[model samples]
Target: MAAKQVKSRQRVADHGEVFTAEREVKAMCDLVKQETERIDSRFLEPACGDGNFLVEILTRKLAIVKKKYKRSAYDWERNSLLALGSMYGVDILLDNAKACRDRLYEIWEQEYKAVCKKECNDDTRAAARFILERNIVCGNALTLFCVDNEQQDTTEPIVFSEWTFPFNDARIQRKDYTFAELINAEEPKRPKKEGAQQTLFDLYPEAKPEPDEEGIFLQQYITHYRRLSENG
Candidate 1:
């Protein structure tokens, strides 16, 4: 059977929003068979519509995680979180973005519960949810700016968190960067002065360094896991 469609006809017309069928999603993903199977390999869906592509990618990664780490709960949890961290998405519609985040969380939560059972804790689940919120965002991929749900303005640049585990520790480290800077990192050129000659690369935004405190703040924000680890 074809995959269920998520958006209305008007939405499809207005935003050109159409979810890909499961079969096609799998077929296209299979073309990059090696990357999809590698747990830490990153995948970004520029026009992800309710995460049709991301959901499948996460599922594939989790399957690998399960096979390799099933016996070790710690390994399973850590690797699963890593898999979640690697899948990113951006959607124009707010509803689609929220739905995609929830869908991805549900996929992760189910597997986590299956493996961890009574050992599954809320802090771990919260960490997974937090990762999803940052990874899958509501934004205009073309403009590289996030859409404000209340004002429907594209004024804010979409910032994504990069999660890392230093020295195989349980602590999660996060660094944030604007989508514009990330996508244009290699090609950005400074804008010409009033009388200077123009260049093609000048059209791109110049990359800026992320604030040092941003990581500290993110670490503090997701304190549930921190506190739980301390207590344990």
Candidate 2:
């Protein structure tokens, strides 16, 4: 059956919200076949209504992770986290944003449970949910501002959490940057001085490194997950 395109006619008129069919989504994604299959390739959907595109991208990436790392629980968990981190989305509607995150988490949880079975637990599930909460944001992509949850009318700069994996350790380092700064990283900026050109670094400042205390907490969290998996 063809999925319902929009919730209501009023929504279509107000937000110009129309969902792409599954077939069309596949056709468009096929254009970037290589990137879609690559585990670490990052993709951002500016108007990701209910995450039709992001869901498909995650499915593809997860399939690759499964093929390569399914046998090792640690490898599978790490690669799965990497795959989830690579996708990002923004939607103006808060409900859509929440739905998208829920959908993505559901997809990941189902797969993890099926493959890992007894090994899948609450800690791993919570990690997946945490990644989705950061990745799929409720915001105005054009303004690069997130809607304040407490006050719907107010907006805050869209700060994204970036996760990095180190080769020597299992700890994932995190950094934060405003969406505006990240997107404008490559755009040419007006010269700071009359005769001087602006460098890329000047255009986009470095991401804020996580605080030392937070880093310690994050490592502890990961260690807890490892200990749970081992005890199981």
Candidate 3:
């Protein structure tokens, strides 16, 4: 008999914990296949801790690609390795990030070796290695900013000023948006009822000041009453 599935587990899967189960992995692959008509696909795991999702995605995508093409086993392996670019990930921990990259590379290497029926070359290995390292960046995904929060510079380099290059150029600098600031700005702007309502008497028929009061004290009294009435 199969073991019982654990219930009441923690909310999110961390670095050590395996996030995607065997069944879930298959389900995800099915979803991907159904949604995308194209053989080539792209998948990204924003918080990929140890690359559980990426590994499954790579495995399934490769299998599908190989079956569809019906090429030789060598082609199958080459295409499988090439599928690494379809997957991307990000993790904060350096060690975990490195381990995740290594794990993905190992999967690629194993498939490549089987297809070649001989040792893999430096170029093939290097391609896999580069994809793993560069694609799986070491950074906090939560801190990641979208397009709107990008930096702007009126002061341009004297040379590039003539040509209209994008102010928020990726080459210029890597920009980061504050999650906190965005959240704060999104909060509802409360109406200024208190301050605005203070002058509400100005709209009333009796609101106009009386010039009929001739004496200084009477004028002051009238002014005070007007102020008090308006405020109240």
Candidate 4:
């Protein structure tokens, strides 16, 4: 059976909601094969309707994590979370945003259980959901603002958390920035940060990514990987 590309005629008329087929998604992701496989590499789908592109990227990233860390449950858990944190998505429809998060969580859960087995715990599961909740957003990608139940733009801006394992330990650092601001700033070249596998500026040099004149971010905090639910 073929993957359904159109959900309904109303969705297409209202929001132009059409999912990419599996074959096309895979082919598009294959174009960035190396980046998709890199555990900490960032990928954003501006209109990620039900996560066609994201799930493919996550599947590739998890395969790498499994291949490299299957021997160690600890490594598998940490790297898997890293892979989860690296993806971001936005969909105008609330249902699509929720579906995207659920799809991502299921993918991570399946691999986590297969690799960690007895080591799996609810805290880790909560942490994965936390990342998905933060990464997958319901908003208008054009306006960079969140949407209401009716999919109308709200006053609140769309803010994205930049997640990082800054200390080479269990601690995960999160930095918040408005999506519009991150896209507004630009640097001629990406900088290599001390602890960041890839900072916002590193992953997206165009991101001014600083507290100074170059860029302005919202909040910064750190917590244990499993306690990411404690974060905002």
What stretches of model 1 exceed 4 Å from their correct place?
A: 185-232
Quick one: best TM-score, which candidate?
4
Q: How are the candidates ranked when ordered by TM-score, highest leading?
A: 4, 1, 2, 3
Cα lDDT, all candidates: 0.74, 0.72, 0.46, 0.85
Which lDDT value does model 1 have at 24? Answer: 91
Error of 3 at 192 (Å): 46
Per-residue lDDT tens digits for candidate 2, residues 1-232, read 9978888998899777899889999999999989999988999999888999999999999999999988987778878888888889988888899999998998888789777888877777777777788889888787677766542434466656665564334555444456765765422222223323222233223422236542221111122223322220
Given candidate 3, what's the lDDT at residue 203?
45
- What stretches of model 3 exceed 4 Å from their correct place? 1-18, 35-39, 68-78, 145-232
Steric collisions counted per model: 0, 0, 0, 0
2 or 4, greater by lDDT: 4
- In TM-score terms, candidate 1 sits at 0.79
Better of 1 and 2 by lDDT: 1
Off by over 4 Å in 4: 185-214
lDDT of 4 by residue, 151-176 (tens): 99887788888888777888777887
Expressed as tens digits, the lDDT of each residue in 1-232 for candidate 3 is 4323332244233333334566775676677665333334656677676777787777666556656543464345345544765566766556556777988887777766655545446655664575466567555555442212122221211010000112212111111112223233332222223453234234443433344332111011111211222321
What lDDT tens digits, residue by residue, belong to model 1 across residues 1-232? 7667745788877888778888899999999989999998999999888899999999999999999998888888888998999999998888889989999999999999888788888878877887888899888887777778652546566777676664366655455567766765432222323434222223223312235543221111122233322221
Q: Judged by TM-score relative to the true structure, which candidate is superior, 2 or 3?
A: 2
